[model samples]
Target: MTRMSKSESRHPVRKFFLFALIAGAVVAVRNAVSDKGGSYDPNEANER
Candidate 1:
């Protein structure tokens, strides 16, 4: 069996933090979109 190096051992922690950051960003964007009457369409020209 191969042994894990010191750097490799921190992969899970790094992934967890990365996932948390992404999740927080998504939540923030979702909240902003929802609070804006939920009518923000990216493909509509009249949205401006």
Candidate 2:
């Protein structure tokens, strides 16, 4: 068997974190875009 460099061994781990970050951003954007206007209102709070 052959030995691998430190950078080479960490490459896959770096790639996985990058992919996870991108996926999280995509899900957040989709959730915001698909919202159906159920937002909160400061003025409405006074009525309660």
Candidate 1 lDDT over 1-48, as tens digits, reads: 145665666578887889899999998997788567566555452544
In model 1, pairs of residues that clash are none
Best by TM-score: 1
Candidate 2 overall Cα lDDT vs. reference? 0.66
Which regions of candidate 2 deviate over 4 angstroms? 1-10, 36-48
State TM-scores per candidate: 0.59, 0.53
Cα displacement (angstroms), candidate 1, residue 43, comes to 24
lDDT per residue (tens digit) for residues 1-48 in model 2 = 135666757678887899899999988876665453333443444554
